[model samples]
Target: MIESSHTSPSAGWAARRLAELHLAAVFLTRLPLPHLRPPLPALSAALWAFPLVGAGIGLAGGAVLMLASAVGLPGPLAAGLALLATVLLTGALHEDGLADIADGFGGGATRARKLEILRDSRVGSYGVVALLLVVGLRWQALASLAANPLSAALVLTAAHALARASVPWAMVLGRPARSDGLGAAAGEASLVIALITLAVGMVVAVGLVPALALPMAGLMLTITAGIGWVATRQIGGYTGDVLGAIVLLSETAALMAATR
Candidate 1:
């Protein structure tokens, strides 16, 4: 068999891309991978693989759901356990972001106040309420979908992948809120990376559930964009907390749309 002109180079690129994916997975989730201790620049470059990391998280959640269900748990309980698995997997990273952003936006009267609120370690009333609402909605939506393990797993996978895919777009559309933080440190992902994430998300959505694909995509995009807009207007730009909030909210929106 004759090798194509592009074959060797493409193969090499794929191999390197796998490293980026591992970095992204490590950064985004608590899952153990061989530690490479790549520099910040390499981690920033790995942003392209964030969605794939999300997909892995979703699969882990689904596996939890399946195990719970097989052990005689009800859908609601299984769904809750599955959601819990994801929370643990990601160290509730985005959940914490959602709470901080909520508290900051709700309590702050000025941009400075908002940023300060975001920095505080304590959770306020706004943060508590936001977590309740988000977590409750997710549990309910997952329960509704979890009646069939296969369907629920597929939806979870698609929801997670698509939700993360929105982050690069959000990053590209909004500037960092400050001189330092994960948001600024991430720099600006290229349009190519953004589009690739979007494309991968679309494929996951359509492949998982053709009927809900358009609606899920629309919901995810709208929610993510709205988040970006709100973050920019409130804080002058995005921060690490803002990006985390975007991912969690987008995932919830996608799951709700998929279930409906």
Candidate 2:
């Protein structure tokens, strides 16, 4: 779920879109786009650009992997560098979300307690274990793809793009868990925005690696659907942490699928 958005019709179409992309870049990354003057697009309106953000992230990480490999780094080390680049770029936004969700869901005994735990900034044993498992899985999968630069780039790019497309869908999975959190703050995104985002992700991912189109799409959809379903069952709806978990898990699965 996109956490913040603001838009005004006063801005021209091109400028509005640029601003929207800028907004997405800022929220989803550590990019230095700063404040959009005025006449900014709403947070929900900028949701469609989430895939672009993912593509950029994937490309950035893939580039580092390729470059590091070119400089004689081992595939495993190159993959680690690539993952580090992404973590630095995004400030581990999704990873942090994943950890929070794991800790909250695994430790909390009740819905209210779960929400409270999600809000806590501290990491628990559950969060640490979950992060270790998912991050380890991602690192190993990426290392496997590092044998070919082209394949590495395509898979990484597709994985990130398709993974982020799940955001809007995750947002729409159900009502917000908290009236004051990400779910409620993101508001109700239109079906159109969600479809456009999905379309962009499909085009980018399939275009990058046409051979794995079905697998990529299938794993992404499956992981996201499963995560969203679990979120709904656990807390009646999706939370910010739940959405983050969706992004990381989906991305991890996509990267794994790419290995095929």
Candidate 3:
């Protein structure tokens, strides 16, 4: 006694999956989503697309660099501008997370105190130092890589994607640090999703930059595990801000592998 539309089950599933992708894109980027009104379930399901969003952002940043170079800008200048574009696109989401994690871990004496520090809106000394190191090192690395636009684009694309994949990777390995907040709200991700995320990231990264694949993957995985360990020890679990720190540090490690 049910009225059915023309949509098949497989087609409906595909449509829902595509909606999750759109949700991920909207959440991760500054881009507008006029038609899509994804629910909280969609958001939770979209974690796998986090790296895909990074790929889009990285490619856009790389394109900006290419355009700048074509216009006669110096490699350093173009690199800085590309970094600026990425910051703008993501609204410095990960950057802010990095700052908070630094302030929390560096300044807090106890776990509760650390969590309290992280929730503050204002940046602290630890946060400032962390931001400077991350931004400065990223700028320098991008500048050096910018000498070869093709290589720069490939590595940036791969690094961003792989770095983002580390978030769910951490979530899979650690529990939420708090009872409530963004980290908890993300819910629990499964190991299968984590593995798929890592696999996709690995394939894309190695496919693009075959020469530095082994070293880059080795460094990225080591750094990712190291950050996860530090977060687990310091806070007893992972937080949203910790996930952000993981992305920035993981990307930096990968980019460093490509540096000459």
Query: Against the hidden reference, what TM-scores do the models get?
Result: 0.92, 0.94, 0.94
Candidate 2 lDDT over residue span 23-132, tens digit each? 88988898776788787677788988998999999999999999998999999999999999999989999999999999888999999999899999999999999999
lDDT computed for candidate 3: 0.84
Tens-digit lDDT track of model 1 for 29-69: 98777887444345557767887888889989999999998
lDDT of 3 by residue, 1-260 (tens): 98886899899888887887787788787886666853434455778888788888988898998888889899999999998999899988888889998999999999999999889989999999999998999889989998888789888888888888887778887888988988898888888888877777777777888787667667766776788889889998888888888888888888877895
Q: Compared to the true structure, candidate 1 yields what TM-score?
A: 0.92
lDDT of each: 0.86, 0.87, 0.84
- Of candidates 2 and 1, the better by TM-score: 2
TM-score, structure 3 vs. true: 0.94
Alpha-carbon shift of residue 137 in model 2 (angstroms): 0.4
Residue pair clashes in candidate 2: 5-42, 5-43, 6-40, 6-41, 6-42, 6-43, 7-40, 7-41, 7-42
Displacement of residue 134 (Cα, Å) in model 3 is 1.0
| Residue 68's lDDT in candidate 2 | 95
Better by TM-score, candidate 3 or 1: 3
207, model 2: CA deviation in Å? Answer: 1.8
Q: Please, what's the RMSD in Å of model 1?
A: 3.3
